[model samples]
Target: MTHASCEPARITEPDLIAIRDDLASREPIFHRPEWGSTRADFERMIAEGFWETGASGRRYSRAFVLDELERRYASPPLDDDWESCDFHCQRLAADIYLLTYSLRQGARETRRSTIWQRAGSDWKIVFHQGTIVQDA
Candidate 1:
């Protein structure tokens, strides 16, 4: 009898790009012009075990992110114009993906990345990090 090893499924670059682009579209949900709309959007997508690193050098848990998001939503509005860099995505596993990009709002630019995992029928962000870039 011969034993065979099973390899994971393969993903093409184009497919990976599509997946990444789809996820990126969700970003504006957090920063929409209308606070009420943003809050409503945030509530639907957050998943368990979500963690993120803030540009301020602080680590936040899912609960903390939610709380902070709510507080920010309640604060006075601001004039925010943001520019984003090209997105890069990689498939870490059959169901895991990594995405990286940069966004500049005003004079501050931050490089950000996120790891997304398949959660049942939908995708959810498992980890995220944002680092301030000294030079644009």
Candidate 2:
């Protein structure tokens, strides 16, 4: 029998704080609807909005993220969950911002966050995470 090893993905305190700041607010920090539809939409969002997932202990390189995205595209199409998403954003610095949101699909609900940094005239994501909310 072979045991597969898995590493827990972790994000830094500052990044966590940035994400939390967005979540703490009742109002959305920013709004962009075009980046929330299909895999291609999200890929465009990732490419144009984030540099990378600046998260530690996870395989979140640009190639990795792209590959993962491609894999998702290979699967059956998902519902347009973003249409019902509750989103929020917070600025961590002059060009650094955190976006957080919750989405519901079928019977499952998930909370997600991403950190973005502005480079030149574009914004790039440096970190991302999604957590499923379970019923009590």
Candidate 3:
């Protein structure tokens, strides 16, 4: 007989639940319609210096990402379902935080991280990266 088991995913640190919940709801970034569906709206959520490293290991700049997002939003996909779990957050500085989680889109899965900075009551995206999980 063969048996298989996997270790448990990380739990969100109790101290960071409030911040983690707030950010998790908006993660996988442009998926939540309630958050905002327009490019201008997205532009407001990300910092001027925002950037990302895709699961492909390619770097994307603020302008490039926004432009690509604008194009995708023009005619949104019908099957846009994705799920995120195992969120964990840490304070990077005063009002700055780092959030990490696992994201699954259909069969594709990746580990994601985002840096956020809070200005007053609003959070702005600073940096984000997604690395493909092998043998998942």
Best by lDDT: 3
Please give the lDDT score at residue 113 for candidate 2.
Answer: 73
Number of colliding residue pairs in model 1:
0
Candidate 1, residues 1-136: lDDT per residue as tens digits? 3333463233448868778777677553356443234555565566677788888888988888778777886877576688776677788898998877788887888888888777777667788888888644
lDDT of 3 by residue, 48-108 (tens): 9999998989999999999988888899656776889988888988899999999998788
Model 3 pairs in collision: none
Specify the highest-TM-score model's number. 3
lDDT of each: 0.72, 0.53, 0.87
Return the candidate ranking by lDDT, descending: 3, 1, 2
TM-score head-to-head 1 vs 3, winner: 3
| lDDT tens readout by residue for model 2, 37-103 | 3556556446443434222324365667666666765765454433235455567788777676665
Kindly provide the TM-score of model 3 when superposed on the true structure, using C-alpha atoms. Answer: 0.87
Worst 10 residues of 3 by lDDT: 1-10
Model 3 score (lDDT): 0.87
Off by over 4 Å in 3: 1-11
**Clashes, model 3:** 0
Provide TM-scores for the models: 0.74, 0.50, 0.87
Over all chains combined, what TM-score does candidate 2 have? 0.50
